[model samples]
Target: MTTLSIYQVSKPHRAILQTSDIASILKLLTDAGVPFEQWPIRPLPQNADAAAVLSAYQSEIDRLKAAHGYTTVDVARVTPEHPERVALRQKFIEEHTHPDDEVRFFVEGSGAFYIHLGDQVVRLLCQAGDLISVPAGTKHWFDMGPAPHFTAIRLFVSPEGWVGHFTGNLLPGLVPKLDSAHA
Candidate 1:
């Protein structure tokens, strides 16, 4: 299930709002200038390659590209067996901002995106079929958990793909991780 939790940046222990309702999540995120939606899931082989994954969602990818001026699209898959899971998690767990919108569609598994806005932080737990677009320059961090396992389709306006500008804020470390936030 998908969950959304809002917390004060200074007080990470308690959430101001928490719910698993999709409608509420969409409304809240939309009000916050974040694009949150769901797309129908497509069946794919267990070990589908990037090309295969892209082919499965070609229509949607084309639509997003046309709508958002996205110039690049790719698939990212990470599993617990990945040798660099620890380093990859550390890299994304810190607060960072992108030059362009950070868009992603979850095709398998789940991950949590912590979006920092004003005094509140929104923890969005995204599962399969969920698509989230974080506007450019938004301070946020992603928690793929200790043993990450997910397959996501990422879109970028720039062909350079993901380039993070770290905020150097320790707030991400203070907040609850994916498991705790989901609970």
Candidate 2:
């Protein structure tokens, strides 16, 4: 199940709101200018089950299909053992650009997503069943944790491939981390 708990950047104890309802979650997040959704999730996914996770997030898939005409869903899982985890984390922290909209469906585990849009900073705690859509050109960073792990489906619209537009900003390691209780 997808869970949402909003916190005031200043106040930590009193939650702005918390809920497991997808519609309401989307409404509040979207109203806050945060793009999120709930897609059908496949279980114990790996190997070929990756495709199942992509299909689970139909709305996002549809968006990609219509906007960029992306085909061939690739389901991927990352754990503490993934060799590229360190490099990928470093790459994501630099705040890069994507040729197509960045869409990810969290099939397992949780990760913190910080979107830097001008003066506003939106931090999202994305867990299982959570669907996140980051528009192309948005600057952002994702933290999977010290033991970094997750199962996600990726969508690409450009045949040229996903490219990173590094801002050269030291954004990753400097960002504050969220506690697991709230994450």
What is the C-alpha lDDT profile of model 1 across 92-140, one tens digit per residue? 9999999999999999999999999999999999999999999999999
- Evaluated at residue 35, the lDDT of candidate 2 is 68
Stretches > 4 Å off in candidate 1: 181-183
Once model 1 is optimally superposed onto the true structure by TM-score, how far is the C-alpha of residue 88 displaced, in angstroms? 0.5
TM per prediction: 0.97, 0.72
Task: Please tell me which predicted candidate would have the highest lDDT against the true structure.
Answer: 1
What lDDT tens digits, residue by residue, belong to model 2 across residues 27-98? 866876666866555555455464556556666678767865776456667788888887866656566667
Which ten-residue region of model 2 has the weakest summed lDDT?
174-183
- Displacement of residue 155 (Cα, Å) in model 1 is 0.4
Candidate 1's TM-score: 0.97
Best candidate per TM-score, number? Answer: 1
* Regions of candidate 2 where Cα sits further than 4 Å from its true position: 1-25, 32-34, 45-64, 178-183
